[model samples]
Target: MVSAVPECGGPGDLPAPRIVTDLAHGGRWTSLTAGGREWLWHRDEPRRAGVGPGDPFADAGGLEECVPTVRGTPDHGDAWSRPWRRAGEEESVDCPDFRLTRRVSAGAGRTVVDYRLTAAPGYRFLWAAHALLEVSGRARAVMTGG
Candidate 1:
């Protein structure tokens, strides 16, 4: 499914976020209402081949790289699972194309990571790989799907 990037936020050496470029891609996860949740952060550019623009939101069962979910192991094909929580900086793991950086804030109890839809050129669009929080049965998920 091929598409073009709108002229409004055309693709280029895309502008970087004020404090960090991570937000321009996805964003930081603040609070988790549940053990699982999902979100989509719009990109200023266009989507890539694997992930098309205005694409639907994906959970644990969606495409491997299209979303971010905790797994028991680091395997790409593994299912989502609970991750161990520690402190301080973390070691780096290699990914095929995507570049991910996870930084846990000891002061704020929040995490920030940089996410990209596709590791191709001239491609940018809304990235749903942002921080996702699952809510309990009684809670509700609400967002203006604009």
Candidate 2:
């Protein structure tokens, strides 16, 4: 089910952004709002209850963590289709060969996400932070730093 982390702004801290996470639905980040603007994209239609391996991607329009293989038989790897275990701010999902964990924290007018993958030695995999942003046609992406 979807869980929400309401807006937080401690007395001494900057205003924290608002976030919605769906732990039952692959731990997807369904909504993110900062500075009175929603940065993530949401689907116009309803979403399916549950998604499984080999099932059509819900494409509910949000942020998805694609683990191991993004173009394999399961489409977006095993994480996006399975439930995650949550402990405090951390959420994790287990694949056949590895375990992926993510910790999300927000404060000081910023949101931070940390990911960790544990697997046997020499195991190789690919990961993608599949984030869909709510942007207009004229919006242009700007990147800085290395």
Candidate that scores best on TM-score: 2
Show how many residue pairs clash in every candidate, following the order shown: 10, 0
The Cα local distance difference test for each model comes to 0.28, 0.81
lDDT by residue (1-146, candidate 2, tens digit) is: 67666666754665677778888888888898876789999885355455676676778878888888788867877788888888777788888889999877766666677889999999989999888899998989899998
Clashing pairs in 2: none
lDDT of 1: 0.28
**Can you tell me which runs of candidate 2 are displaced by over 4 Å?**
6-14, 44-47
TM-score, per-candidate, Cα-based: 0.26, 0.85
Question: Residues 66-146, candidate 1, lDDT per residue (tens digit)?
Answer: 222333123221111112121244312223433343443221222334332334675332223333333356867668976
Q: Ten-residue segment with the worst summed lDDT in candidate 1?
A: 1-10
lDDT top scorer? 2
After aligning candidate 2 to the native by TM-score, how far in Å is the CA of 126 from where it should be?
0.6
